[model samples]
Target: MVPIPLASEPLRIGLLGCGQIAQAHAAALRFLADDGVARVSAVADPDPEGIRRVAGIVGDLERSYSDGRELIDDPTVDAVAVVAPTRFHRDLIAAVASAGKPLFTEKPLAPDFSTVCEIADTVRAAGIPAQVGFQSRFHPIVRQLQDWVVEGELGAPMAYTIRDDQFWPTGAVVPGHSSWRAERSQAGGGALLEHSIHSCDIACWLFGPVARVFASTRHVFGFDVEDVAAITIEHHSGVVGNLVTVFNGVRDREERRIEVFFERAAVEATTDFIIGAPEDSLLLKQDGAPAERFDVDALRRATFAADGFDPNREVFVYQYFGYAAFASALRRGLDPVPGIADAVRAHEVVEAAYQSARTKGAANVADLRSR
Candidate 1:
């Protein structure tokens, strides 16, 4: 398909929720609007106060709806930005697919692997571009790393290591607030599904598909679900990907980072920077030497955060580039970096990871394929 020119008129967008992540989506839409390419046409939420808050962000001229279905059915809206809870993802995707509009749903696509397949099949059959909100792929360093790998810069990675550590402060989750994140029925798994989805997708993108998975989950922090997890995966290329997901505040680690070891040389790329090659000591290092280093700004020619690596730990709170990329793809026929199919695959990985953790054995990826 020939690539269409960027839309001359602003693409009309609507939000399905007004939660914390939804604020980031709205900010991204505002950024697009500043460029004269997209606008937030409407917002929908059951809470009138929440609806007003989101609507106020895009201006009062935008439409507001008490029910998301009504907003989804609105004829004026061209695309939908779904930042609702994980539980609502399947229903919202199905609803919007039936409505015949492009969609961008936040990650973990649904509560489980089975529901994710239903959403994926629905979007696929409808022939519409439905994007999963895996924003880290849009990070400049990540994109460059993927490009380098695909271009054979690293000479085919033999293994991948991903580490993500976050501290979900106790009081951050308001009590009696009825948050979907705290409920297993809504979030599926805790940190594994909620936070690990990003790392899982990155693993899949770096290495083709998952072959097998062995994982473990423990509620070390006493949350409703597991707060710490260790997952080991075998990719189709026989490459191994080891992932460590932690929600502890004790360890001092980067918020997100991936280290890829290839046949030619090893490359370590983080959300803020990338380093490799003999020039910077990336490959020629005998012991503890700095390699070639590429900072965030040096990558995409656009800087999302001012302070570089330590910009903001709350990644989802300010994910504009990704949402803009998704909006552009849906409006102009470009491919979103991590679309709904990727989400389905990520869900499959998470499900397998949890199963492996429970059974204390390896889980075949093929066995987890939804019916």
Candidate 2:
């Protein structure tokens, strides 16, 4: 495997794509700049306005390119973040891997499972460190849930339900603005792939690998993609769960609420879909006991106690914890969490769901994984 150079200087990150998500990463880089961890040194976007807006957030970037490949070729860029549309991931990941740069890509890694596999293979062949943006994995409530699972506090898993909803990303939602997400060719799939891929990842993380899935989908917004999907998943460990993902017309309404039940306890957590803050809450109720609520800040402090950074001072929105963790891993020359393998597994589950939707029966996740 290629080794990341141990450097005292801040890691220079080249950002690809300057859309809404790119802007969030820019803001995160700005936050991490205070600790000398990383900074946005360059940005690439076909849209000048996007580049300009991201530059405004990051401030005084060393370089900007209309083509992402140019940014990948720039020697000064220590690492690269590919925030471009799903359709463009395959080519950009190939380019980044060829250049031997550590890469951070937003999910879904590609529009389809086969392409995601191709990109993963490219990265593996190049032996470069890679991370995929399942930022929810870094959410404080999610961390606590993971801890609960590991500590057996939740007892034997019984069932779960995750509802992920977001304001539809179309011109209708934001007047005069067009979203690539409205196109199936660009976004791969709607609701399920574009949004609740995070939910799929979180489910697998908290439970176990999904064994099979049965799904149904709807195109309520009349887009080429499905704006709603309801999937039932059976895990390898015998836990069963339901996930509902929707891209609705609700203005500025983005939310995810998860409720998981076990033999000994039940846990429920709620947070904003795109940006989770310290004030988000999680509640736990053991058998014959009252529900106890915990704010995200308390969980964050408890989870990251050894990191030496105070959760109160840092901005928790824009997935700051995820980026901070990425920067720290790069600086330490360690592999990042929620890596490409995690992304591939999530995509496999999503693909299986889509297949089950089409076949009108349960689809085996292992059937896709075997390929």
Candidate 3:
């Protein structure tokens, strides 16, 4: 593996893809650059236009390559971020791991569970620090919900309901950048994998590992992949929840809401996945007490402070926080949270849900993991 970078040295990050998501990482890296945490030193993408777009955001990159492998092999790149398509993740991850560079990859590690396992094994064998993009985990309201669950501040957890709806990527929402998301071979699955995989991860993070799942799906957009999926999950902790994910025709609107019910309390949170959370984003009620509202900005500042970051200097977007955390972990020579192992666990639940949909019965998550 590459020598662990000291905390004082800024990590030189090489980005493997310069698509839409890559732009977000570039912007985040730009923010981190001011703090001497990291900088976008190199970028690779087949599209010259994409490369140009990201270079504009990061400003003065050391190098840009048309081939991702060249960027991976570049001596000056201290780490690599894989923002490629889901179908390309396996090979890119293997290349980055083999290069002995730390990796930060976007979510749903791969389209299939077995390939996700293969990627995890490759990263483990290489002894590289790796993190997957489950960015919502970095949101302060979500962190507060986790604390409430873990500290038993809300008695025993009972159930949860999470609904995530977005305008279909292949539709007018994202334009030219999102066509691959509609293809089954490229995206692996439909709404379940490309989108709600975050919901699966969040469900497991908030409650515990999923025990079993029963699911049903629909092809509202008539793509080869299902655009709508409804899943019922039973957590190992005895918490049960229903998740509904849809890729619809809603223009300029992306909605996400998470409501968890406890034995004595209830918690609800709402936010735009593209933008950040709105004011009064969190609501809590315990027993006979009135519901309490929380300012999401204040909660976010407190969360950043607890993590030893200056809230005023940090970007408020949830995606930026994940990249920041990854950069911090790289500086400290430590593995980041929501790592590949965590991705595998979340994928296991998703794969089980798919299996249940196929067989029209509950599928055991442990059974999928055993193989």
lDDT of every predicted structure (CA atoms): 0.72, 0.85, 0.85
> Model 2 — TM-score against the truth?
0.95
Cα lDDT tens digits, model 2, 84-141, are 8889899999999999888999999998889989988998898888888898887767
Considering summed lDDT, which 10 consecutive residues are worst modelled in model 2? 271-280
* Candidate 2 accuracy as lDDT: 0.85
Off by over 4 Å in 1: 1-8, 169-178, 249-254, 272-290, 300-318
Tell me each candidate's RMSD, in Å, in order: 5.4, 1.9, 2.0
Cα distance off (Å), candidate 1, residue 91 = 1.7
lDDT of 3 by residue, 1-371 (tens): 34485423578889999988898889888877877778899999999999999999998888999999999999888889999888999999999998888899998798888898899999999999998989878777778888998999779889999999888887434657567787778788988888888988888888889899999999977788888999999999899999999988877767789998998998988866643444238899889999998877787778878977786654745666787788777766678888988898889888998899999999998798677
Worst 10 residues of 3 by lDDT: 271-280
Model 2 ranges with Cα > 4 A deviation: 1-3, 6-8, 274-279, 300-306
Count of steric clashes across candidates, in order: 4, 0, 0
**Candidate 2, clashing residue pairs?**
none
Tell me how far the alpha carbon of residue 216 in candidate 3 is from the true structure, in angstroms, after superposition: 0.3
**To one decimal, what is the Cα RMSD in angstroms of model 2 from the true structure?**
1.9
